[model samples]
Target chain A: MSTQSTRLAARFMVAPSVIVLFIWMIVPLAMTAYFSFRLYRLLSPDRSGWVGFNNYVWFFNSPDFWLALTNTLLLVGGVLIITVILGVLIALLLDQPVKGQGVLRILVIAPFFVMPPVAASIWENLFMHPQNGLFAAIARGFGAQPILFLESYPMPSVIAIVAWEWLPFATLILLTAMQSLSSEQLEAAEMDGASALSRFRYIILPHLTRAITVVILIQTIFLLGIFGEIYTTTQGGPGSASTTLPYMIFKQAIVAKDIGRAAAGGIIAVILANIVAYFLMRSIGKHLDA
Target chain B: MARAASPRRRLLTTLAAWFVALLIFFPVLWMILTSFKTEASAVASPPELLGASWTLENYVEVWSRSDYPRFFWNSVVISVGSTLLGLAIAIPSAWAMAFVPGKRTKDLLMWMLSTKMMPAVAVMIPIYLLFQQLGLFDTKIGLILALMLMNLPIIIWMLYTYFKEIPGEILEAARMDGAGMWSEIAYVLTPMALPGIASTMLLNIILAWNEAFWTIVLTTTKAAPLSAFIASFSAPQGLFYAKLSAASAMAIMPILILGWFSQKQLVRGLTFGAVK
Candidate 1:
């Protein structure tokens, strides 16, 4: 058989799954676009009328939208910064020949496997509770009033929790990258009388650029849609202080039952995600090809 | 290359690392401890780390109050079912892309992955509406289907990465030997890529098991997984610290055990191509 025909046959074999995914992606997206243009609300059936760009106008005009956007950015940025910094430090530590390395590694990665809801609930009930939490107990031991992590500093608390979960992931990636570093290059630098800082800055950091970028990109993708932690922890509470885009969309759709506004929020989210994803994909795609 | 650090420096660094590890793990550890405490003891000031009269009463109460066994079984079935179904579909798709040269293959893969980036809330309304129309709401089959679809992209991506690592000549050799497609995949490819497939399955099962939003939104009592089971404990009441902790611990222990056992595979799967 010709190569072209063989390729065609392979395509045929792969078509069903691809087509299903395509429909799944396109249909909901198209519906969101349609709803974004229409004036539709769940509460009023008669409000289903053609009102192009009205939902977007309201969303763009609303202070809540800007607040949610800022919160989303803060959450994503804070998580990335915390996870990458701590991940590198932890990876460097674990890379050393330490006792009980296997156990330490397991302990480090354990948080990533815990379900988001479970993690959030554990934090809410056991670790961050104002009166009875571990932190509160520690505060009380020092004769301090218990401070609420979620109520007073909801976004930061959520960011910290998310960073905690993702740090292990970043560490695992960075550690794997660290392990694959060529010893010859390091030895060469050392023989040339390079200091540890210089070696790391010049060689190690460059070697890690791709891995770190991958970590940032992938984590950003997941972090943008972070819902469970925020929901379980704060429920976007204390007067919408912690409501990110995903939470906003959820509120519009599930709580308010306004399909149109929720759909608009959904479209905006897609656009925002695509913008980030496009750049990340381009960089990672080029790196993979190379 | 070998400047030995001082003992003090080594100890400080090691201590710091352990402290951070312990800090990150404190919540889970605390939850386990809290699960054993009475409600009042759970909320005690200067919390008793060891002096709290330890009891399994909370566990017995939570276990008897909720249908935990049923939820556990539902979680197992949905997670395993979705993972297996996703693998069944993904293996072939990934195999085709990895082995065949096509102009759109990369684009197609990216598109599928992009679908994952679209937040679930974006499509929640339509999905809810569709499920209601189709009478799929609150059904295990519905959840299994949703999870399989939700996780299909990651499965294919992981499988594609794994399949790409195998040389094409091996599969070509099987083809030349008159082994059909089924035998080629089942007899040759499956065994060669078993590790990757295993990791993918493990990761998917974890994801499905932990999935909360859809499980909570879609299913109520009958088919809700541990995620929903845990969420149900969160009430408007002022506090239910011990019960919540108990529920959280129960929900997490099984997956936590699974995670502990498969830590290596989880790490490798997560960092699949990041290192290279």
Candidate 2:
């Protein structure tokens, strides 16, 4: 029943976003690919030339690259384990008929709203600082030495901060899924002599499977590029102990002024992200048809 | 579902819940509390919970002594400007997809979402070099456009999901009344879509305001937002607990309040409406 003009109008309406996003995706991506093969250092422009595969070979063979790869995996894996486990427990608790639910919910979700720099500063200064930090105070009260958390356990410290930022996200999604579970099914299970643990494991956990997958897949995408936390807290140091892929790229481009190498690393980051995004798109695609 | 448990059990559950909530919220609560304390007391050994000589000096110092207000203004302009710009672009696109039912609309949307999945670092060198060439580096206009592009996909996805819920029959009714396209959208669609628009705006604003990556990376002193401003303190000065708390609290409090209101939309918008 729709006429030609309506269809034309729809095309006109959608054009700006499509065009803007198209350029946004393709132009930078093309430039990155182009630069990866060129010897373009911001500092030494006179030295510029086509480097071919040298940049990628150098980036892949660097010690920092391996350290960053391991650290990135550890950071992503660590935060996922922490957030998902704690998120499930927290979500289950929030789903209970507890008083002050509104305040409790706000309290739990507050960390997610915090900017990364602020969150890093808070933990780095207020709680994780070896001298005046609260953890130090507690250690002293127990007649023990205060550990230099960032120095001694840089990856774990970074993981903790990032996990704090994302815990609420996982909890919120899982809790939403938890609330949608039909009570009648749980009641029937209870009547069949299933214990509380069995009911949760058999009933609630299975119901939350999709939500859990969403949380893991989505969080993995964000966590894979963890930069601000590392930048503000460790600067990917005492050495390359905490340098993830994004931070490594940042150091390469902004600090070292090595555009060619950073572009190479950037392309690698894209490939790594696309793998996770492939699964994420599939899951979201499933929802589209339903 | 509302069947009463024993009083003891209920009390225990409440206690457990509150305890865990506080434990999770402790860092934020401590930051807010420390913001009121004198610098010396802020780092007091065997840290005082409430016994510290509370003062408003840190807030005053953070606000007045440094260029705090300038960074705050930059954050405001960038987040709000980008969101408004994104809304202008997204509303029409989302509206068309929701109403027009073109064969490729789903693919288009998925593609838009895929753009978001491209890691920001993937194009860092290009964007940085482009910004330098275009004189957009370390400027408010530059930051605004970057954040806007960063968030445009979410804005479209959220609006598309919202607009999809408004029945086609309503539009058909408007058409039968002889309203033209512009008039139908102006008179009928805008009013119905306002709430959804507002929710999307709020959520995107929070996202833009708290966005740390581009804001920190792309700007120096002139255009640095609070995120970058706070990142400056990562060195020795960050050890000033009271002042750091004050600055951190000021940077996050507004979005925290906004976030509580938009928690529902957060799930829907972030997961691309898959969970909901």
Candidate 3:
């Protein structure tokens, strides 16, 4: 099927996308790498100097660095746990011969389509608000004290919002994967008097491994940059309690005008991401026949 | 045939699943219901379910007070424009890689997918600085280009997976005929691959539409999509509950409908086609 002209044309055809992505990756990355070494503060626009990793030193030495790193990891880890666990349960339920499956599935996937800002604000004002939120209302109705969600439990609250947004994504993906499972296998085990738990353990769990891995990896990529929801809801507030790495970088660069420091933080994030990406790239590429 | 569940089990499953689904979807549902309430009733304790007098006043006020249409228009142009542009570049690129095998093809595909893993914040400074320097900041064209670049890999990956599944024999058969390259693609590939292409386009548009990070950071006013519009509520405002709900509902309604319709492709798109 591969002719000489077609082969040449293949290289030619793939060039534009490749070149654009290369520039997208390399140029800003190079600038970020270069600037991370130089002391470039936005406040004093002309005071650029060769800092020789001073920015990295300062970024690491700063208290927010480690705090933000922990928060970042926890946010990713927390949301991944909540969403993937609940997503699996929901997918399993949806995979059953339930009534109104179409409507139920639509309701399930609705949250994934809502923009982050809307989701956060809806939570902030309507669900998580201390005085007047739905939770507060529910608490008051039960003759209990209304809890301050974002104020007292900032990290968990932020995790909740982000998990809500991503739960739909995991469920949608996992549900599709579950739908693709061969029903005959499950029925075969059932015919042999295998208990439901045993069937799930032996067949369903094994089949869902790939989808689960894909969910974790892909969600990890987006979860590492949990910014908008935090920005809108917590603003990484209550003394930087919910300040994830991305928000920390944003604050350093935009709010503090510390470009070099932010660039260093950016570098740190890139290294961390590539660490995750390394495994992901290997897995996805591991199975291809060509 | 598979044995059917007992009626009682089906009822129990339906009840349990619906309860959980509704619980998960409650925030969005509550927002929609709240949007129809007056300012006073919206924040009412015990959370009026159907007790409040329904009114369109909030929607009317939101539409008149804010530039809702402008944000809506920008969201449309950015999502739709970026998607179409992505399709143009991706279709050919995916075609080349899928039909013509190279030793590095899988490596290249993996590399491209890895691009999606790069956190946007990692390159925030340079892109921000460059956009400011080129006067591309806070403009629709700037956003369109940034988002298009941002989502290029997904576009290519989705199209590649879709194209790869078309069975190479079909294209080979087309080649065996007297058809030239142009017709081979235009007639043979286009007609057959249109559904996959359309689904890819749909999922990409949804992603771009809901994209918050770049949309919020890159543009301040002129190019601010619904993301920024909704983010404006973060600042403390007086008695904005109903209006906030109204705006939130408006922001989510279109994509919610679109997402519900094209969910299958979204699964394939997000999983790098591994799941489907």
Candidate 4:
């Protein structure tokens, strides 16, 4: 067969998967957009009639909506702050010529491999248990009151747990970018009496900007849908302190069985995530094309 | 001129780095240590690290009380099954996109990736309703399909990147020699890209294994994976600390071992194309 025919065959082979992805992406999202304007609760299916924009109004009018939106922003912002700073620091540390570097790298990445539910459970049970947790025990030994991490500061606690999971990813990506820096440049800086801080700030940070963008983009995609950690850790509990958009959506749809309101909430969450993702994609697209 | 000061600073930096690494690893170590302690010792006031009498009772009780083997097998089936199915679909698609470039190839790839950016919960209700309607709510196959679809984009993206690294001339050479498309991809392209393919498969398996949302929501008792198994111990009233740790250990051990062995490949795969 000629190359043209072979290419045609390849295209034919690829079409099905592409179509599947397209339908998978479009249908549910269209349903979500449609339901956002309707009045359809799962429990009250018979009484459900068209109440256009009422669901969205009801959702936006609720104080819980604003609270959940704020929580989502805080969760995303807080986790990003913690992960990026620690990621760069750890990336710099791991980049040095040190013994057992491989093991240390593994130790750092191990948390990322851990299932979120299991990680959250471990943090809650083994690390954050007020009675038997390591932190509690250490606190008592130091003559301090045992701090209930999730209970007292639900959002920050969730943020910390998630940061632990995501920091390695940022570190790995940034470290790869760091290793690509030409050693000659660093050597030149050193010969010119450039201090460590100067070299890092002037040379290293500039080199890592693209990698940082990629890390932030990728991590935001995952963080926007962060359900397991919040569910397993706080269940959005202690009076909905840790309930982010995704958690709120889950509770509205699954627990409350208010499908229309949940659908509206889902649409809002998608809009919020996409707004963040749009900027991220632009940066990533520039980096990829460059 | 500054060698003496540089050496001292280097030593201090190395010490600080090790300290931070230890701090990050401390929780996992603590969990493992707590697993070996008795319930009383695990929760002891002083939090004895090395002084507690080690016991295997937690592991034994955890194993006996739950069908751990079933959960383990479920996890293996779902993760491995999804990964294999994903690769089976992704390889051909990636091969086509990488070699047979068309006007819309990049657009198609980007479109596929954009699907991943949508929050899973946005579709959660519809999927749940569909699963219930189709009678697939609590089955291994349901979980497998969900995970496969979830990870397919990443698999295809990684494979596309890997496939792009291979020179197109190599496949052209095979085609010129009268080899068919199947032979060109199966016998030539695949063997050359085996390492990349292997790493992609490994990473996808880990992702599928670690997935918690759909697994927890979709499965109940029969097809619940280790994530669900560990979560069952989180009772509001129960204080099963030792057993919880043991269950956690059991849940994490497989992936932990996998991560330990494949850390190099994982790091490389995750950072693929980022530096370049």
* Candidate No. with top DockQ: 2
lDDT per residue, candidate 4, A1-290, as tens digits?
Answer: 23688678888868767776766667878887777777778888888777888888988999888888999889888988989998999988888776577778777777887788878887887778787777888898899999989899899889989988888788878887888888888888989999999999999999998888878777888888888898888999888888999999899988898888898888888888788887777657776662
The residue-by-residue lDDT of candidate 1 on A1-290, one tens digit each, is: 32877677788768877876766667867777887778777678885887888788889998999999999999999999999988887887777655566777777888888888888877776777786677888888888888899999998888888888899889988887888887778888889999989988998888888788878877887898888888788989888899999999889887888888888899888888888788777767666542
Q: Model 1, residue B141: what's the lDDT?
A: 92
Where is model 2 more than 4 Å wrong at Cα?
A279-290, B235-239
Which candidate number would show the highest lDDT if scored against the true structure?
A: 2
By TM-score, highest first, what's the ranking? 2, 3, 4, 1
Q: Please, what is the TM-score per model? A: 0.93, 0.97, 0.97, 0.95
Per-residue lDDT for A1-290 in model 2, tens only? Answer: 56899899999999999998877778999999999999999898899899889999998899999999899889888998999999999998888889999999999999999999999988998999998889999999999999999999999999999999999999999999998998889888888999999998999888888888888877887888777788788999988888998999999999999999999999999988887677666766464443
Write model 3 residue lDDT over A12-130, tens digit each, in one string.
Answer: 98989998898887789889999999989989998888989899999889898899999998988899999989999999998988889899989998999998989999999998888
True contacts kept of each: 0.58, 0.76, 0.83, 0.54
* lDDT of candidate 4 over B1-276, digit per residue (tens): 112236666777677778888888777777788788888787787877778979999998888876887998999999999999889888889888888888888888888878988998788877787788988898999999889988888888888888899997887788789988678768998798998888898888898998988888888899999877665557452357777777787788888888777766665555444544
Worst 10 residues of 2 chain A by lDDT: A281-290
Task: Note the residue pairs that clash in candidate 1.
Answer: none
B154-205: candidate 2 lDDT, tens digit per residue: 9999999999999999999989999988998899999999989999999999
Per-candidate interface DockQ score: 0.56, 0.76, 0.73, 0.54
> Roughly what TM-score does model 3 have, to 2 decimal places?
0.97
Candidate 3 has a DockQ of 0.73
Off by over 4 Å in 4: A283-285, B1-7, B235-238, B267-272
Give me the TM-scores of chain B across the candidates: 0.91, 0.97, 0.96, 0.92
In Å, candidate 4's interface RMSD is: 3.0
